[model samples]
Target: MSKSFERFQRRKLISSYFSVTLSIALVLFLLGILGLLVLNTKKLADHFKEQIAISVFFKDTAKQVEIDELQKSLVMSEYTKSAVFVSKEEAAEQHSEEIGENFLEFLGYNPLKNSIDVNLNAAFVSTTQVDSIAAEIGKRSFVEEVSYDRPTISLLTENVRRIGLGILIASAVFTLIAVLLINSSIRLSIYSKRFIIKTMQMVGATKSFIRRPFIWTNIKLGVFGALLAIVALFGLLYYLDLNFPQLGVLQDLKMLAILFSGVFILGLLISLVSTYFATQRFLNLRTDDLYY
Candidate 1:
């Protein structure tokens, strides 16, 4: 009966070890997902910054020479990426197609003024900078008005800033919660081995001697968890890229590599830190307190 009881205890210990390892792996995977979301948010914001365009409208009676001069000045501006002059007829046609109706017929003529469509450098796409550029452009003698979706630009800028802040705060909070939870799980796992720890203490085993094997075990568990999280992150990214080709631009080799590395490092760091703290707490527990 003693032999059977010993075998049953061994089996239970092995099962508990595996359970703790799996839980660590799951926590690492959650950290990886959070890292990916933060990195991708920045990448998506840059993509949007590159696509926003600015439009410059000319006066109704503005001459082609004045328009050409304005275009030249804009082209020479430091913030300008590219500027193209759109003749009155082309603008009218574009408006007609966009509105899905003959706006010229209702006006009895092409009331649309000639304009220049300007694409600014990505770095200058912010609301304040874009407004400054528009002011500079409006100072020209032939310029009638500088038109842009001001509210939309303001909203986008505000939203991106808010999202970035929110992500940072949430990531910090989640990381703290994750570490505490993981540490608690590890402590529970170690609690099951309290008898072994007590036996070592009773057998003249130094604290370092008792801890060495457990530290190595925890390291191995951490590496395994990090690896699992990396695999899961890559699988999710692959599916997203396959389903959403519009996001293909974000799949750049450098960005993907950075993201993968960041997630892997995050997993490894969280696991190691949680394990170290959990083991330390267990090592310091009094024999009397071990029951609790």
Candidate 2:
């Protein structure tokens, strides 16, 4: 081959490689964002559920000793994540701070009952479980009433569940799109080299010999793209942490590790699979079909 012609071929090959890698990186980045949302959905849900609590008020005749005992028992239960005892005075003070007035002074007496604010685990925060826990706690001798907004809790749970389901469905659709997109981009990258493959075939190159370099090179492209996507994902997360610190609570190392590993494996596997099938398309085509 002429030196100038060989140089031109080399440039085309390098440009094709760069194009495929860039395309894969962008697609993987989009996939990574969807993956993050899917991974963090549970953490966000748990955070909201942890905010829910039930207030248990004791009877007027219930003594401090009896209330303390019942509080201890409630805290020991698996359903109870935490229990905070609030004296009538503390309750009055809290109400005063929030309402900007001391109702006790106006009424000539403290009217609030001694209560325990009970926070449940995520699993127990649902409507059914919370009701079951409330009923069980109410059976205590010193407990007068166990109060929580059942309607509000039920509504919130339903809304969150629905939103989570919607996200999952959206993620699935996006994932499929990502696969097809990466496949098409890689195929087009390979399409540029179809004539070269035909030339090699004419020179007695075996199918494996022809496919080997393409498969290996594209696998490397997939890994590089996935790494790029991972870096971008973390960069976005860091910005979120700096500006919106509350979101930092959802950044668990274990889950993030899973996400990173998933991104890499997904990119690698999809690229390997797509490249194999993509090369096969040209391998099965006739020399006459190259123009199409």
lDDT of 1: 0.78
Task: Assess the local accuracy of residue 9 in candidate 2 as a C-alpha lDDT between 0 and 100.
Answer: 84
- Model 1 — which ten-residue stretch has the worst lDDT? 263-272
Please state the error at residue 141 of candidate 2 in Å.
Answer: 3.0
Candidate 1 residue-wise lDDT, 1-292, digit = tens: 9999999999997787777667777776787778778877986876677567778888877888888888898899888888999988998888889999998888898877788989887667888999998998898777888988878778878888999999999999988877776677667777777778877888898887887777677667767766777787778778888888788734577866876686567656665676666666777778888877
Please state the error at residue 44 of candidate 1 in Å: 2.5
TM-score of each: 0.86, 0.95
Candidates in order have lDDT scores of 0.78, 0.89
**What is the C-alpha lDDT profile of model 2 across 187-255, one tens digit per residue?**
998898899988898999988899999999999999999999999989888888889998872357887
